[model samples]
Target: MKNFKNKVAAITGAGSGMGRELAIQLAEQGCHLALSDVNESGLAETVRIVKNRNNSVIITNQKLDVADRSAVFQWASQAAKDHGKVNLIFNNAGIAFGSTIEGFEEKDFKRVIDINFWGVVHGTQAFLPYLKTSGEGHVINTSSVFGIIAVPGTSAYNASKFAVRGFTETLRQELDVMKCGVSATSVHPGGIQTAIAKSSQINESLKSLGLDPSHAKDKMAAQFITTPKKAASMILKGVRKNSRRVLIGPDAGFADLMQRIFPGAYQVLVGKLLLRRMR
Candidate 1:
């Protein structure tokens, strides 16, 4: 846990953004990587970059949808078989959705939950055995600042992230109770620079809440003050320390503090700030 050298790490969403940066950094530190992403081109690019930078690092990649339980399990098996043993699983694949609860479509809500929440579950369950066999392992699940504080027009995203937070925390506790060498950390990241905004499902429902869906994505992207490389570095640091929760940016730290101070009252401040942004 204190070092990554010779460790085998499986990372989902490794095509770009934080995932790609994590792979690159881990490779630089002498870690072997098993990478996957739904974006085939992006995945290839990540592999290319890792190879170009660290030719000695072993890597295997797959075009994967983390929500697919069988596929994730299969990939886990393959990664362990190929790498000899697996030591880390970064369950980082996620998607964003923006809509009010009243305007949210069931299918869209399900999609966000499936990929953002269930995907983490699948990755953990699939790779857990391999991690246990390795005798030193870590599970990193990506949540968000929204998981700590809710705001308008992001009900689905908030739900999914919140679920991830709860699930990962519980998993971490169970791992501790079992005295397993494996550990888990819930990652609450602020707006780190990533492609999530461009690929988010921002529906017209935001209009019903006096928000403009057309400009929402751009507005969200503008708040991304942290870079993916920095986020990746912080995450790895957390893993080395075996932190129970990791907050990536200043915004994330502020959100966590606000929730601790205001709890139920923070909703009003969040609503006002979001409305001001939309206007």
Candidate 2:
């Protein structure tokens, strides 16, 4: 927990963005890695980058869909087998979706929940036993600033992220009560520069709210000031400190503050800002 040297970590969504940066940084610190992602090519690239930098670090990868419970358990078992013991599981794999609650499609909403919420559940349950056995462990679940404060045109995404925040917090409390060596941190990243926006599923329902679906990705990306490297560094620092919650960027910090100060009234302010942006 103090350092990653010689410790083994299993990361979901290790192919790109903060996930890839985490793999790179952990390798630099001499941690062995078990990486998984649905994108085979991206997963390969991550492995390649890590190997090129640290030949001594052992790296194993799988083409994994974190939404699949069985597959996640299998990967967890394999990671434990390959690395001998697992100290950390970063449930970082998630997808983005944009839709108005009234206009949302069931299928689209289900997809978002399955990937963003259920994926974290699967990863945490799958890897937790191994972590307990390791005697020192941490669960890092990626939420979002929206988890702290909701906005329009992202009902499904907000639901999933809020679910992650609640789930991780309860898990952390249980781990503490049990006096387990394992702990959990809920991460709220405020639009770190990532392909999530470009790759997001923006529903036509957003147009019902007078928001241009086509411009949604660009608008979201424009808010991403923190780099992936910076986000990863913050996350690792949180892990080392055993922090209960990790806010990645200044925007996340601001959102948390606003929510704390205004609570219910912040929703109105957010709505006004979003309406101004749409104009």
Per-residue lDDT tens digits of candidate 1, residues 63-172? 99998999999999999999999999999999998888888889999999999999999999999999999999999999999889898888888999999999999999
**Tens-digit per-residue lDDT, 123-191, candidate 2:** 999999999999999999999998999998888999999999999999999999998899999999997
Q: Could you tell me every candidate's TM-score relative to the true structure?
A: 0.99, 0.98
The lDDT per prediction is 0.94, 0.94
Root-mean-square deviation of Cα positions for candidate 2 versus the true structure, in angstroms: 0.9
Candidate 2: residue 211 Cα off by (Å) = 1.4
Q: What lDDT would candidate 1 get against the real structure?
A: 0.94
**Candidate 2 Cα errors over 4 Å, as ranges:** none
After superposition, the stretches of candidate 1 with alpha carbons farther than 4 Å from their true spots are: none
